[model samples]
Target: MRRPAAFLNLIFSRRSIRRFRPGKIDAEVLKIILEAAQSAPYYYQAFCFILLEKPEIKREINESCGGDFIEKAGASIVVCLDLNRISGLLDRLGIVHVLKADTYPVESVLGVFESGLAVMNLIMAAEVMGYGTLILDCALYECERISEILKLPHGVIPLVIVCIGEKDENPPPRPRWPLESLFHVDGYRMLSDEESERFLENMDKAYSVEGYLKKYAGWAGSYREYLANRALLTREVRRAYESISAFLRRSGFRP
Candidate 1:
């Protein structure tokens, strides 16, 4: 096998950093990161970034989104699925039929897909530039409140918040499922109950060694318990889902 490129190492070494040293990112460096995002391959170009640098704005977002680390980062960037720009262009070109009610679902999916590609590029660029970064999806939990705080207009929905800054702590990489379970050959491979249990055991042992349960969920004894405690069928999770759905509908991404 050919050796991996040096840049690929950056992807392997990247970790989600929560603690950051106090310092603002240089304007030139931030501009380069944004340029990298623009370089991502896209089918519809339906994405935009809202950069939050002010302490007050960051504090507001942190409160609304429930990511306490957001306020401490050098900058927090909201990566949004923005179909508004496309809708405007279509309007100018007299192509209104493309964005009719039936197409909203398809547009929403495509917008999120394209935005994810851009987000990966933005993150890798920042990592290669020696900045610690954290990706927070908590923004989705309170999307309506966040939209109000960010003053997002129609046809634009915040997907994730990327926080970048200097690293204050160095931690080992988090545990992940085995590659055999994740990667399949030509066709999908179904795992047996035994295989599933083995994978879970391995993950639980690894997380226990790292003290992940104590740090994140002290009440949970194992990683499996931690996951069970955060089950999605609960009332709070349902409310978050409802809020996200309402935001998507109001932003014209849902029918």
Candidate 2:
């Protein structure tokens, strides 16, 4: 695949940024970036973007989700799925019962897909325009509280929060699995023990524990501890999953 040099550079140089300088993005630039996000391909689902530039709200979100970088960054954009809009349209068409009858695989799954597509578009656009962005999954853990904070409606579920601003730090790209490991020929193929071990060794060398700590020093914990901490990974993550599921059901997305 022969990609243009500009597109390849954008893809290759993009990185998840945590630290940011104190400066607001230009209004015109922000508008164009949001327009890029809106241009993403969605499968008939309406999405909403909430821009948060207020210092107090950013502080509240930082306290709630424990991602301090959010407050330090320039702004946060909350990407939400507008189920109410879809439901309203369906109701007007007199076919809202179709969703009520078969909701398992549609409402819950497709909304996420649409939001992810738009977010990626926004991220790439910001990166190309000399800005940094971070996708904050912590918002989902405190979904209800965040909903209240953002003043979101009952059917508008916050899918992901994106932090965008001027970059304060330049970091190297994170290590990824080798092409052979990620790209299986035609179908899925599980890696053997040796292959898996080799991959782990390569990653360990590419990104040592010291490197991880230095990069995310604000987290204030070892990488191993971060991974082993059940409070954040298991408990909070499970709660986030349940919250989204319950939100969908309560919003009449159940069969």
Residue runs of model 1 more than 4 Å from their true location after superposition? 102-104, 217-219
> What lDDT does model 1 reach?
0.82
lDDT of 2 by residue, 48-134 (tens): 888887889988888987857777777788888777777677878866454555446577567778888999999998988899999
Whole-model lDDT values for every prediction: 0.82, 0.77
Which one is best on lDDT?
Answer: 1
RMSD for each model, in Å, please?
1.8, 3.1
Candidate with best TM-score: 1
Q: In candidate 1, residue 34 scores what lDDT?
A: 90
Model 1, residue 231: C-alpha shift (Å): 2.0
